[model samples]
Target: YLVGGGQNHSNISGGGGQNHSNISGGGGSEPHVQGYKSQNKFLNKEILELTILLRNAESRERSLEVKYVALEAKLCQVESKYLVLLQDLKSPVCSSSEQSPAREVISRLLEDALDNTDPAEHAVFKPHPVSEYDVFGFRTVPEEDDEEEKLVAKVRALDLRSLSLTDPEVSVGVKWENYLSSTMNRDMVHCPELKALMRSGVPHVHRSKVWRWCISYHTRMFRDNLAPNYYETLLGVARDKPNPASKQIELDLLRTLPNNKHYSSPGADGIQKLRNVLLAFSWRNPDIGYCQGLNRLAAIALLYLDQEDAFWCLITIVEVFMPQDYYTKTLLGSQVDQRVFKDLLSEKLPRLHAHFDLYKVDSSLITFNWFLVLFVDSVNSDLLFKIWDAFLYEGPKIIFRFALALFKYKEEEFLKLQDSMAIFKYLRYFTITILDWRKLMSIAFVDMNPFPLRQIQNRRTFHLEKVRLELTELEAIRQTFLRERDTHTDAGPLCSDDEEDN
Candidate 1:
């Protein structure tokens, strides 16, 4: 009817009829209204199409970033192999004793070359030529903090020779490099010397290779049992599927290492690589999904590993090295470790532990992240890497040693601070400002000697059961409260039935 009326009004408007001019004017505007609606629909369609295009472009860009990172890692591996060959050629053929120093000098030169090259030169994650970030790709503290500055300067000025526990006569370093280079690698049990060498520290040039070898040595069973291209397959599955952890992973990508130059910007390649590593792991282990501390593990791994290698390194750490539920929602494993840590603290550092207990200080508050992230942000990068060198080679027991060492190293200073808050605040920055890595490591290994791995395992088992029982009791209490609340709701108000009847 409206269409018919409009047609009649249109005829009247064209006939110049003054009596129906208002109707004629309304009809005359009808086409303009229709045109505007059509235009709006077209624009909406265009917007929808463009939005999809933009999303597709972003997906492609991420894919390219992952590909680029993988390729870069392969290139680095090739370069490393080539450099090893070159160094082998340069070394003099002589008696083992005479060749030792030559091999050391050659390896040192190779390390310098590898360190000097800017792998991320064309990449977005290149570190700036400034003091904002340390050589380890961690951000430096503000200059206003004189104490932090002084400590950082001390660490920077530390002679490299002082860092090594082994002397020239000790053949640990030489034997370690040889074992790492050999095809038929022996287990840590067979090569006990590697432990002493690792405790001293893996050489900077061979650190990455050493980590790969150590992780592979430990996780060989897990890695070998996997199908070919398992990591890549995980990545493909993650890319195609919408994971429950993807959103949380996205939120944490930039937050993972924002201070580091590699992850400074949102669009940095490190961010993408981190995202892929986490996302792939989430897909690989849906039960664990993505957890808070995994990012730190993966980020640090990335500094010395490529994207795929980093992903597998994470798997090795989370699934193989750590106990079950360490990164679960409850973090029950972490809590259990903390409980065990407190127990060890009391036994090892009795005075400090007694002091903490007297002050009502919960030691776990200061040390939980240390356990969760393996002291990533708690300590300076250089020392942290040294700790990791031992950690990957020695297993989680290294964490307990280091944790005890930190408190032991600062026991005197800690005893002076009577206030709990002051102690907590001080402990936070003290590890980062450690003047000497060697002293800290010594305190961990030598000072905390006879630190039995078996004891840690036994304690962990005891705490795991205790934590489970506590959680069960808490759940039962919650259920009882919920049941009572439901009963009360079902019974209604005391006066409600009578009032309704009335």
Candidate 2:
């Protein structure tokens, strides 16, 4: 300290010593004049350094943006020229008018220009962009929160269904059918033989028996693991004491794959089956009640198994396989999957993720419904059913495999897209185009070492721990609210709607 004229001066620094500053008593917080000047000098130096750094960053960003545009433009030009040249060589005369193939060229550009995107994303899509989805019909964008993602406003699958496969895929499917028919009657649920067969593909003829065998005999036989009386008891509750969830379940049921013959009418067996399953589940897990997406799960499960088995399949899907909060009242679980998926995308497809971020397009906006319905209307009927078979045997992580594949395959188109709606529309249009399940799954699961069971479980464990902590906090808050509520004279019934805020 230095004695002054009616003032004192001392030195103070954040660490060991002080500079020309005073930090003594009431006005000690104020820096000395000299200290202030020194700080300003230091700050000016830092500002200049930071400004230079920022300028460098901005310059680099602009340079990269230019490079990206040039790459895309060159890709598009080369891609268009190649398509035109091929068409001309194939045709008797070379002319652009006879062969108006810009769309095809664009599709080729996206797929063939492998150098334009990371190989991981590049590998997922096919060389062709043409899908039956492009030719078939209209698509209405679903509302943001609409769980019944019946986005394919119209689908004409019957005409295509009548067409013979006329390929080796049919024979392979047949081979699996004959093999399952011969050996699946055995008492044991799981075997190396069974797993190998499923990995190939379960035949439609043998699906019912195969699914039942897998669930009943193959899955764990613990009572707590089973939803034995849950279905029956819940159905009884739904029958006797009607609840609020029942109405929503009915509305969702009406919209659930409305075009599918089995579900078109309210009086149909499929609709009734869906209603019973949803209602029973609502009663079974009152906390979640009947979430919108569960209807699709039950509907598909019902298609493959009996009602009881179907209920159990959904139970396994929602409770055991999936991150639990997925279908909760608040949908807290699906959000976690988004976070995990975002990390995976960043690692697996950094370029695509950066493009999305640069355009301010959130991954969740494009991915939520995909996870919710397991690619219900996102892909064609054939793909959806096949994914379900793998999804069940493998676990919920298969959806991630499918999702990563969706982005990877469509990276070029995704990159070309500038706005959120364009990206979503592109996804809706292109994802369903690839009717070949074999090729799609090959890129997703086999081509690269996709996420393994352990990785998924680790992330899920972290999410569950987070949820547990949140619940503990929520419980404490609830207790505090109760105490606070009691202190008020006009504290109504403790079960007020406001309590949900906790």
Candidate 3:
């Protein structure tokens, strides 16, 4: 959060419209110069001291995080042991081969938790069950087959050099496993090595666990406040009581990721899981209830996580990760983000922003879904998960960083285009061709350094107010129109009667 303090201070005078001439009006030039120098020295010293304090605090935070994760890990072990003990007490004499029940059960549970499958293998297109369908489950058009083939080939060719035993990531990968055996700590992102690993990508085998860990940490407070078996409770309630959002949920189930095998068929397991999760969430958060974008979020989570895990991840994303009302009927928070993003675009990629303005194109047209669904279908699955790895770790700022990086990545090309239509077309489809996940991440995290969370929060606050006011004015206008229509309707018959009498 302190990453951008100095930069923010430099922009203070520019941001403020106050005149500086008044400061020197009463004082002589010599005194003013001396005073300025003294103040500058004091400010610099203060900044240095504050920076040191923040760094120390950050270190302490990391230590506490490690401890918290360790404790959680121990708790899990205890729970596993308790379950084993209970089983032992209830069981009769078992086979000699199953002597170490605790170890055997724990090993199986660990294996289930940490899937060792090749991530790329999941992305390979499967042959359609029927002649009309293509691999990955979507019904195929001849035109789309070429594009799908290229994406599949890119997935197959994804680099795995970072996973080698000799690589630094391998060592950090061990730390990641240990870190996740318990709860997640927000400060863990401060670790340079872990941060790099997450930014590069969580290994496919560990991705689900890491995502669960991060989300669990984020929603820890909310989870703690809820009763035990909250998800199950919510599920039961949803089954007993009809949710108003159930129809919408059912409609969206088939619409979500039809191309994926899990969601391709009407009776697919993924479709059922998606339905249950969305229904459960609608019951869980009635305020926002069910939103269209959430279906995609849950669908993506279900790709790696099971039903319960995906549900919690969706909760964290909608309730904790994003701002409130982001997916509400009005979607005020989502609209506010679009406004904030446009400002960020202007600040971070002024040329591209200017190009967008010159073409009379609102950037939000291309970016609304990007932010709404967190770029699910915009990027390939491999890269989508990579983006999400950092997103879950770092927070929403990752979205802005990646958004800016996209425009910056293709800035020159975008500028080369003559008209808005071509630009729009490129913006729409450019992300699908992003084969270099590492470069995209590097551009987001490294090149876009000091993209602080505090700044984004402030921008959101500012835009939220603006959007609220705009909504209010629109409402007022609508009210005035309604009143005028009512008055005209009431007077229309009387006017005709008076004309007939005359």
Top-lDDT candidate index: 1
List the global CA lDDT of all models: 0.75, 0.66, 0.73
TM-score: model 3 vs. ground truth: 0.65
Candidate 1 per-residue lDDT, tens place, 323-376, comes to: 999999999999999999999998989999999988888888779999999998
- Please list the Cα RMSD from the true structure of every candidate, rounded to 1 decimal place: 29.3, 30.4, 26.1
What is candidate 2's lDDT per residue for 392-473, written digit by digit as tens? 7767778888888878877887888788778756755787655556667777777546567788667766876786688789
Ranking by TM-score: 1, 3, 2
User: Which ranges of candidate 1 are over 4 A from the true structure?
Assistant: 1-130, 141-190, 493-502
User: Please, what is the TM-score per model?
Assistant: 0.67, 0.60, 0.65
Which residue ranges in model 2 land beyond 4 Å of their true spot?
1-167, 181-185, 188-192, 217-230, 418-421, 463-502
Q: Count clashing residue pairs in model 3.
A: 2
Compared with the true structure, what per-residue lDDT tens digits does model 3 show for residues 358-461?
99888798799999999987876667788898998888888999988887777889899989898888888887656556577778877877788899999999
Which is superior by lDDT, 1 or 3? Answer: 1
